[model samples]
Target: MELDGQRKSDNVEDVRGRSGSGFGQGNFGRRGIRFPSGGGGRGLSLSTIIILALIYFGLRAMGIDVAQLLDDGSSGSSSYQQQSNASGAEQEMKVFVQRVLASTEDVWTDIFEAHGGQYDMPKLSLYSGQYPSACGTASSATGPFYCPGDRKVYLDTAFFTELSRRFKASGDFAQAYVIAHEVGHHVQNLTGVLPKFNQMRQTMTPAQANKMSVRVELQADCFAGIWGRKADDKGLLSAGDLQEALNAAQQIGDDALQKRAQGYVVPESFNHGTSAQRMKWFKRGFDQARMEACDTFSDPV
Candidate 1:
């Protein structure tokens, strides 16, 4: 996790405390933020949009302000500041994020070129509280996610704090694993796997859809492993870094989360695979260090 000498990526958008209202979905199209173009995946429907609008606006009307919770104008305890840019430890964290993202760009771009295509790197949006997205409203509670709709990855860095406090997965490498996993989703979108999954999910039963979701998440875990392997090869990983990544993979597994939340596990509703499955797939990718070797769909978990 010694990213001191690493290059920083410029493909980051720092919207940490920029939201004024966090209302109206921020007029995406009007602001030159285009809808999801081409055949990557289906964007949210109009009815879904209406529902989101109602849910958001209704909360505002009832004085149940979720977005306002993010607006901490106080300087001392706040994680973000509207007027000032990132500073102090927050600034250091941003640098670390950029470095990790740059490493992914280096590794994935080379992999993509070897397979006969250019990697259109997905932008990383660092935001706090809430932000309008082409997919939907992204909140801190949603964790880190890749929005195929806008070809970007959204991260609430506060989640890193949560990762340490709640999940017991605390380390810079663990945080890198989370970022790489979401970037792995962007990989799926670019490689045509995501669109096919999206198309098929429409015709699938709830159980079937959940199964597909597990595969999707597991594959992303594998991709994260692939990045980890490359990073280790580049001498970027420390002695215990790999274990930290693996521990993180295990901690966020569907079964692990379900067990923690409800004191039991439900396999049928598991969309991100079990703890064992996540560890296994990640190791598979790390061992092989080959994209072809990470194919969890046809090969079985």
Candidate 2:
């Protein structure tokens, strides 16, 4: 990961040391709860959803407006404070994130142009604690996510520490892979894949919808690998960069995560793929470096 001279993306919104929107006003809501809509929301993060679902189940008996909490009425899109006093390693990571985002802009812009499409660079927001996004309130507990409703990627800088320390997938490239994967979801939104999936999921059984979700998330992993391929081609990646990202993909797989959290694997409950499946899809995109190779839906399940 050699990004010494790279240009930083101007699209980054650094809200690290600021108060959240008025939504942060003394509310009953806790920050970063992973609640998904019935038919049209990003799949919840594995561990977060399980924990939140347990709490949600207990609260449902009390007649809480779960729907309002899940959707949050879409505040549309907004950027909070721009000033960040982050210093030391955290500040370095921020600059690195900006550069990686700039790289994605360059790579996707070229790819989109070649395919006769215009690419709109997605906004990236750096936050600490909780921030109100178009999707809902983003908390540090929910990890990094892309909100298709806002066309923005939200990240808590603390997640980088957790990614390396808890997940044991440390490296600059691993962080880039995380950002690229979320941006991949933005690509899905741009190409209308997410809306179509959401529409179809309305008629699907829970298991069926979960399977579709695996495809969606796996495809995003592949898209991250596509960005890795571009970085490799441009001689930006060091020798260990690819393995860092691969290790990250394996670590965050739903199967691996569930096993770690609950000591068992439940395939039916998986929204993201298994460890091998995630690594395989990422490799597919890395090896082929094309969008066609990244199609998880049509591929044999």
Candidate 3:
């Protein structure tokens, strides 16, 4: 992918070294954050406040400055300093993420406008090690995920290294596909798909929910392919770029991951689709470049 002259997104939050693990430290439970009132407009319960305080002090005892993790009302606009210990390659990876995110913003905005709707851009947070998100604590082990609660994508760039070394899916486009897939979840949030699924899953059995989850993940994969189509149209994709993304989809498929980790496949627990399903949906979106073609829920995925 040639992103040399592309615009970088301003919606990026560089909270790499400023975050730590603790309950109520992210967008979900930041300092001065407010939750929905209960009963007669009551605030937090006493137990909740005590739990937060205990967690705060415990984190401090471990040499973590909890204040840095709290939202300071200057998140999107704040000028964040890059970690002094960051390597040159890591810096380049950050730039690559910004460019890829910017591309998604551009593509989605145009698509939404064409459909007579306004696109609400989602923020991307870059963190190292462990960082708090509205969804939960995001760590390297969690890879990259989009939090519908905050409409932000949380990413640990180290996952890109792991993608190459462990998954053997390496390339600029593969990394871009990872970012785009999470952003696709942000798109689902805007379209009411994510919220509906979240609500419906509350009443669904574990197996049923896993089935629904596979559809959700495949739609996101298709959405990423749509972005890849747009990027390719703009001459951003180079030779073997599409193959890189397809390989990534295959490598991270539920079947492939399960086979790699354990040695057997359990179809009942499959939530992200098999390698063929992922590749097929992605290719469908890439070939069609239409939102209708990516409807994994209504169509046979």
Candidate 4:
């Protein structure tokens, strides 16, 4: 949680207060999703463009039709000005997210290099209210999602507030876990696991698709643990940092979300695993500290 001296990642896109129209039920149909390209438009950085390319190709390979994935609008320049209003604490949190992202870049870069592959870091888009993505219109209510169609992770900072206030998971490390998990999804995409899962979804029954989703999410939790382990080895983790992340993993488990939302648990619809399953896989990654060891598909959870 001590990011005082850590390097900041340049991959963050701050689009707070930038949406001019509602992405809600009434106006959602008219919103245009932004698909990044290399030309003058928005001039997304190299990382963002590569991520988008990966997503576009991945979706295309899965027969998802990248053109169909896009919404109807274009992202010219946002009319909303950068807030002159953020407090110091909010700024600090933004910096923390950047630092955590940088940490993942460091850890994954080395791991990929060891395997003779290059790690392509994904861009993190920070938006408030609503945002346009290759996946579709997204609001804070959709939570943090890595859109495979855009190869970028979309997050609403207010979700972190909800993570603390509603989920009872509050700590810098806990927040870092969220970012790490989303990055984990990017890792899966790069490794072709995501495409495979997408292909499988076409033929899977609803129950089977949900099961695959659980495995996908649990694998991501393990990847977060792997990052935590590496961070701890570098002395970046404090005494309770790992515990905080684990608590967060448990806090957002499918069972936990369902319980919090509906006051009951439904195992069949659990797409993110239960609390125990989440905590167990995270521990597995922390103990093993390797991507190969975090394979949840072959091992029963």
The per-prediction CA RMSD against the true structure, in angstroms, equals 12.1, 15.5, 10.7, 15.4
* Clash totals for all candidate models: 0, 0, 0, 2
Per-residue lDDT tens digits of candidate 1, residues 1-301? Answer: 9788999999988887666254566533222234343334567777667887888888888898856654455445444553345466678888889999999999999999999999999999998888878888889989999989999999999999999999999999999999999999999999998999999999999999999999998999899999989999999999899999889888999889998999999899999999899998888888888999878899888
lDDT string for model 2 (48-95, tens) is: 668878888878888987776765534433311222323566678789
Off by over 4 Å in 2: 21-86
My TM-score estimates for the predictions, one after another, are 0.80, 0.78, 0.79, 0.78
Deviation from native of the Cα of residue 191 in model 3, angstroms:
0.4
Per-residue CA lDDT of model 3 for 1-301, tens digit only, reads: 9999999999998877654644454443234665554356677777777888899999999999877877564554333333333456667878888999999999999999999999999999999889878887899999999999999999998898899999999998999999999999999999999999999999999999999999999999999999999999999999999999999999999999999999989999999999999999989889999999998989998
Q: Over the stretch 1-301, how does candidate 4's per-residue lDDT look in tens digits?
A: 7778999999988777677365444543334455565556757879887887898888888889766445232322332222323545567767888899999999999999999999998999988788988888778889999988878999999999999999999998998999999999999999999999999999999999999999999999999899999998988998899889889988998888898899999899989999999999999999999999889899997
Model 4 spans with C-alpha error above 4 angstroms: 20-87
In model 3, which runs have C-alpha deviations exceeding 4 angstroms? Answer: 21-85
TM-score of 2: 0.78
Local distance difference test, candidate 3: 0.90
Residue 239, model 1: lDDT of 89
As a TM-score, model 4 comes out at: 0.78
Candidate 4 local lDDT, residue 227: 93
